[model samples]
Target: MNFDRKYLVWALGYLVAGMCVGLYMAASKNHAQRVAHAHILLVGFAVSFIYGIIHRLWLDRPGKVLATTQFVLHQAAAIVMCVGLLLLYGGVLSEPVLAPVLGAASLGVLLAALLMIWLVRQSGRAEAAA
Candidate 1:
């Protein structure tokens, strides 16, 4: 499948997951998972959807290894971050126990952003060269 379509499909999954969390919070009146829920929507759904658009509209090399890596990294990191936040806020785990996981996930998110910037720059150059 094309990266754009794959990303868009996964984005809908994230949207559902995020919405489930939101509905749970609303019903329970427990906003403890608010941070996790927000991250799931923003990073998992919104960012992935935007990335899909970028790949579809801007990139000619959507199948490039770096693009695959960026997508995988972003999804994995976002999931980890969301899970860690949920564990922390739900009092299932201590901050110290999940600190490393959160930190690495945060760095992974930033790295995905950097990869996206590079990909966009490369796409611009490719257009110019063509």
Candidate 2:
């Protein structure tokens, strides 16, 4: 299967898992439990899956080195962000430390989104030129 299709499936699976987490959180009244569920659903599954799909659909190799660099940055950001969120929610990480990690991940995701936009624009331009 193509990368895009694989990503789509991954995204859908994350969505489903997020929904289940949401339901579980709703059923529980504990604050920590609710926060943990939120972190897993929102940061761990939703954000990472969306970013992965966007990257699979949009990233192009101008050079092997650059492409590899981007992939590493993206994956690293996702992993760090997810771990930071989990730690924060579990009360193992302080806000001062977690904020920067989460911020970096947000920036990484934003960069990927921008790359997707650029790729779409480039395709449109190429089609127009043709």
Give me the candidate number with maximum lDDT. Answer: 1
Model 1 CA deviation exceeding 4 Å by range: none
- Please report how far candidate 1 places residue 119 from its true position, in Å: 0.8
After superposing candidate 2 on the true structure, give the runs of residues whose Cα lies further than 4 Å from its correct spot.
31-76
Clashes of 2: 0
Kindly provide the TM-score of model 2 when superposed on the true structure, using C-alpha atoms: 0.62
- Candidate 2 clash pair list: none
Would you list the C-alpha lDDT of every candidate in the order shown? Answer: 0.91, 0.59
Which candidate achieves the best TM-score against the true structure?
Answer: 1
Clashes of each: 0, 0
Give the distance in Å from residue 74's predicted Cα in candidate 2 to where it truly belongs: 5.0
Residue-level lDDT for 130 in candidate 1: 86
lDDT of candidate 1 at residue 54, scale 0 to 100: 90
lDDT of 2 by residue, 1-130 (tens): 5434444555566567556656765677445545545655565566557655654655432234544454455556655665676678768979998898789887886675565456556656765676
Can you write out model 1's per-residue Cα lDDT over 1-130, one digit (the tens) per residue? 8888988998999999999999999999999999999999998999989988998999878447898899899989988998899899889999999999999999999999899989999889888988
Q: TM-score each candidate.
A: 0.96, 0.62
Q: What 10-residue stretch in candidate 1 is worst by lDDT?
A: 59-68
